[model samples]
Target: MKLDVLALSGVFDTGLATVLDTLATANELAAAQGWRTQPFDVRVVGLRRRVRTALGLQVPVQPAEVANGAVADWLVLPAIGAKMPPGLIDALATREVREAAAHLRERHAAGTHIAAPCIGGFVLAESGLLDGHDATVSWWLGPLFRERYPKVRLDESRMLVASGAFVTTGAAIAHLDLALWLVRQVSPELAAVTARYLVVDTRPSQAPYVIPDHLAHSDPLVARFELWARQRLAEGFSLDVAASALATSPRTLQRRIEAVLGRSPLGYVQDLRVERAVHLLRTSRVDVEVIAAEVGYANAVTLRALLRRKLGRGVRELRARG
Candidate 1:
């Protein structure tokens, strides 16, 4: 398939890198599978002929000269930074970007795929492309994103989310997951190979996913500490340790957790540990002792107790179904 991508210059560096790199990986994998791949005709479209990075580096693109081009089968805007300049906003309002968005939307209406990663979702959302769709964005922007576009169902916890022909990703590296998903949609072997090449796990679904809404708003310290704790759950987790990570008292962390999720910090952590334990039991044939150690329980008895408490079943019973 001929995939043409629209990338904006001067967007968030990390977001841009994730989109471009992932697309490159997908294209490489597709070729190995005998799926003819077209070079991405990337047009760095902006208000000016020269695009400059936030760091003062400048790049030259084909003169905003091609005003009339064929609409692509796929349109991707990786990120547009946090805010558009007044002049750029005026240009957008006057229908420059709107025209491009409309062209993509028309193709999408005809079954083409459209995608946005991180802040680029804002551009699509503004053009009414995301109305009545489930989408995602950088977690830091969730509150403002929700306030700006209430029509879009925002699920920030998912690495990536797709609605119909429109695929959206939350935060940075999630863009890679979205690309792998698209590669899988087009060809599963290509997706698997590409994942191997990139050393990333294969995310094989194009449909939206259900995950904890972790990226939604939380007190700053609470969010950071929770994420840190999640990553370390295999070692062990504690409210006191999490509070120390936040440079705050355990009571403060407890209060913040209650304010944000209506649960104590430890309770939330326990939920995550139990959730992982359940997933391990269901998906892997590993022994319960290993699963216990993998999910922060120091002993099989602790794991068994948690399994019964959280799932009302023993680990063995949960595994029996699979």
Candidate 2:
């Protein structure tokens, strides 16, 4: 499959470099695997007919205006800077750019997978590809994006979020995650081989943390459950209750919990509750029994056992440290 890595001018230096490096690694892997790797065809298309790097390197590109009917197997937009290029900005403000974005969106909707890193989400969002879709961008730009594009859901915690054909990364070096994910999607064996070639030791998986701040509100059901649980910690919070509120049975809810979070409903809830209790114990003046009840534990004994199992710290030790 031919993959097109389209690099835009004024793209973030760090994010762009990471994406290019990963793509190069993938290309190398594809060549080694005897897959037909198209070099010139894996293009860097210009939005306004000319592309210039922030460091003054000029890149001549086949403008997007002429790319209609292009059979692109994969479309990638690397991370862009917060500020856009003048020519590109003007193009985006024009009818042609709007139409081009629309065409790209249609192709994407028809099952052409797309990957955008960091601020490149702006491009996808402009194409209306991200409407009502959960995604992550750099943490610093989250508020500005929310202010500008009220329709697109912004997540800041996750390294990346896959919504249909579109995949987006957050700030920092999330390009690594984006590239790795694309490699896996295109060819798992190729991705693994590439990872080994690059000496990269790890892969992106859901980190064990309460809320995972980047994706805290990615899922409405989980977001609402978290909000409700926070406010009603003392009100006999249970998986059944949460499932009922979401209009799903416990079994269905458990399945979703495993699918999204890789954990059972009760297990996830208990972890959240333990996280809360640990925070309360360390930060609050509340006594153990009250804090236990506040976090939905029935009694000190059960709470202690849970703390030992989950927190790995006795309640007394946790409280004493603070």
CA lDDT of each prediction against the hidden true structure: 0.65, 0.66
Per lDDT, the best of the predicted structures is 2
96-202: candidate 2 lDDT, tens digit per residue: 44654675686586566788777677677788888898887665455445645667766554567898778888755677778777778777887788778877744
| Candidate 1 Cα lDDT to native | 0.65
In model 1, the runs with Cα more than 4 Å from the true position are: 29-47, 59-69, 83-112, 202-322
List, residue by residue over 1-322, the lDDT tens digit for candidate 1.
Answer: 4454454555566655665676676776566667664334454544456665545566454433233655555666666554433433443454545655665566577566788876678778876878999987765556556656778887554557878878888765666776677667767776778788888874333212223334323357656866787798887666787777778898988876655544567776776777677788889888888988888878889989876755556776888876
| Residue pairs in clash, model 1 | none
Residue 281 deviation, candidate 2, in Å?
A: 15
Clashing pairs in 2: 156-214, 157-214
Please give each candidate's TM-score: 0.56, 0.57
Give the C-alpha lDDT of model 2: 0.66
After TM-score superposition, the amount by which residue 115's alpha carbon in candidate 1 deviates from its true location, in angstroms, is 0.3
Model 2: residues >4 Å from true position, as ranges?
36-41, 65-68, 83-103, 106-111, 201-322
Cα error of candidate 1 at position 93, Å: 9.7
